[model samples]
Target: MKIEACAILAALLFHSLSVSAQQGETAAAAGFSKDIAPILTKKCVACHGPEKSKGRFRLDTFEFLMKGGESKSASVVPGQPAQSELFRRLTARDEDDRMPQKDDPLPAAQISLIEQWINAGAKFDGPDPKAPLVTLIPRAPHPEPPSSYHHPVPILALAFNPDGTELAAGGYHEITIWNPNEGTLLRRIKNVAQRTHSLDYSPDGALLAAAGGSPGQWGEVAVFNPTNGARVRVLGSMPDTALTVSFSPDGSRLAVGGADNSLRVYDVPAGKEQLVIQQHADWVMSIAWSGDGTRLASASRDRTARVYDAKTGDLETSYTGHQGPVFAVAFSGDGQRVYSAGRDKKIHVWDAKEGKEAGQIGGFDDDIFKLLVSGNWILSCSADKKIRQHSADKRELLRTLAGHNDWVYSLAVDGKSKRLASGSYDGEVRVWNLEDGQSLAAFIAAPGYPAAGETVRASTRE
Candidate 1:
């Protein structure tokens, strides 16, 4: 009986060892799309990806990653980590020789995972090895917003629907819609990026487009149904935040600008990419479509504003008078002139065809954040906590709407209601009677957060 028990125990032990070995093999087979791609995209791809390829090495795709660079050595050897130049640089001892030269070395766990993956034969698991790394990694669901806020979040973006019935304000990972007249919380649309920098409604008000993203990781243009708050579609997954989005006069086309230094245009109905203009050397901060939809004007951190043929993506002209980063841009009602403002603290109006400075609007105390051309009036918001109206043709200051305690980052106007809305960095959204410049309504945009002396119970009841 003792011999039989010993034999049985030995068989069970063998089975356990077999299962352990299988589990180890599975663990060593790190998925390229899931495990390895995220690490490279977050840490290494900024310097070696599509936007800027250092040493002519591009890790934007699996195919380009293995193609190597000027090193002449192979970037990857199917089953040999030591023989791979990419792995060698990652593990190099010399600081200058190490990959991601300026950043700290990759953590040990991540390095070990790469080593094990290579040893396990570095198989391509994604559907397309030629596709960009951003497409390969599955996006995790975004976290939910807090039920109530401890403090106010800066309102960087705001918009009023075409009818001016509801207002939308950017929040942390969400957009909050409110009654412009009553300052009542209507609803919140969730599942957005970390920050929303700009918002606009289509000409017909069928769709609302939001531009923003995580600062250094990725940017996108999120479209939604303003009525029901259902996401319509998403566009542009660039390397950095998409700072601005504008709809064409016909509402058939949408233009997007990004920190990726590229301007992308999309067909609203077909959802197809129309053109990609990359003339700017830095972040493209804002976009404005011409009245006739034939041209587009863009503001950039490159200290220049450029005009482009809307359909062909041809460069019409570039206005460089700002001498600093341009934050806002708009085309005149006639489509013959462009108005741009930024760190220069003045609105520069120029001839669109020749890029010549026509006139300037002075008296701004700080950098301007937005420029809106409504009828004959040009509305602008600035870091000086004021929104000023100027004549589009004469370039004369008309009225100053001042009340925001912090920088006014965005502005929206309603022609029918004769009301204007402005969002500030202090988390305040204010509505004004456009005719008299009188304050109509004001409230903190954060959901479930009490206003001034109001209690949390009172806020939640709404």
Candidate 2:
């Protein structure tokens, strides 16, 4: 009976030691809610969270965590830390392979904690797996009606067709095509972008690319058949509003600048992102592709302009003399020079190859919003209520077209017709005789209030 008791005691002792050893091995086991979640929120969420899923991998919930990303493989392997991609990324020594590509790698202690959790079976006590995925996009509010009929809706962008037969003016949620010679509205392209900020006709005049978005909500680039206004493709649903879009000279690619402080180039045929350039520090307000389609110039609210390789997404040159946000940018016809203007009240010309400031036109009374290169002329419109033309080669002011009562937001030139179009904050659209700087016609783009006290339902379209 004593011998039997000793055998049982030995068995019990062995069991206790086994449990103790297991506890020692996982002494730093991480809890999903306590340790691992916070680390992910702080270190991983920006690119992998609701606003963006870089590789389609989201760390916000357990289901997405388990579903993994484009690879369709598991990110975390329960009970096998060595085999886990998450563990491998956290502990990766190579910068290019490391998680959080833009930031420093996770600390060793934090990595160890994650590894311990994976080895401990990677349990999650957060939201139920069966719960619906959290909505990443917020509900957009109903847009307010236009204030008055007498005052037109503000036009933010303008483009003249390559054939010089039609002009496109960007209005609230629509683009209006007008006969330039007759000053009559042609067709309205409706139900497109919320507020169109930029428009470009493809080189062959076959397509029109419009760029803009609801501020703080979403950004999109919509390509349309110019003849029928049929959408050819919608390229993006970016995190923030896109301010400008330009088609490459070859018409094979499009470059977009956005509030997200990045420049994205999209393949025209594939409708997929070809490259993402992340050198800008703030909102990228404008972008222009080189005449040869080899380089791209971008202006930003970060008070700088950058020129980079269009295909490689490599920074070629940075123009940083502006004291305020750079709102406009354009490449010269020859692609040898770049032009930019902004709140600094200056228009700067840069040497495309050397990246040096070639010339500048200064002394504007207010912010300059748009710049256009027509022939040898550099036409710019300003918040000071004036559209000024300057000689691109000589750096001399050629003419000042003064008719806008409010800030002029956009400018387009028709070299064939010798006509220039300007859009303004007061919802006024004015066409000018470029030769004499005379206003050929003036009309309101947006409908205004009927009279002082009479209630008039705003005409959503003309």
- Per-candidate alpha-carbon RMSD to the true structure: 4.3, 13.0
Q: Clash totals for all models, in order? A: 0, 8
State the C-alpha lDDT per candidate: 0.87, 0.79
Best by TM-score, which number? 1
Predicted structure 1, TM vs. truth:
0.90
Candidate 1 residues 43-95, lDDT tens each?
88898987789889988789998898887899889789999988999999999
Q: Lowest summed lDDT over 10 consecutive residues: which window, candidate 2?
A: 130-139
Off by over 4 Å in 1: 1-29, 50-56, 92-109, 116-131, 452-462
Model 2 per-residue lDDT tens digits across residues 165-255: 8989887777778876666677777557778888989888998989988776557788888778677878775656788988887888999
User: Pick by lDDT: which candidate is best?
Assistant: 1
| Clashing residue pairs in candidate 1 (N, C-alpha, C atoms within 3 angstroms) | none
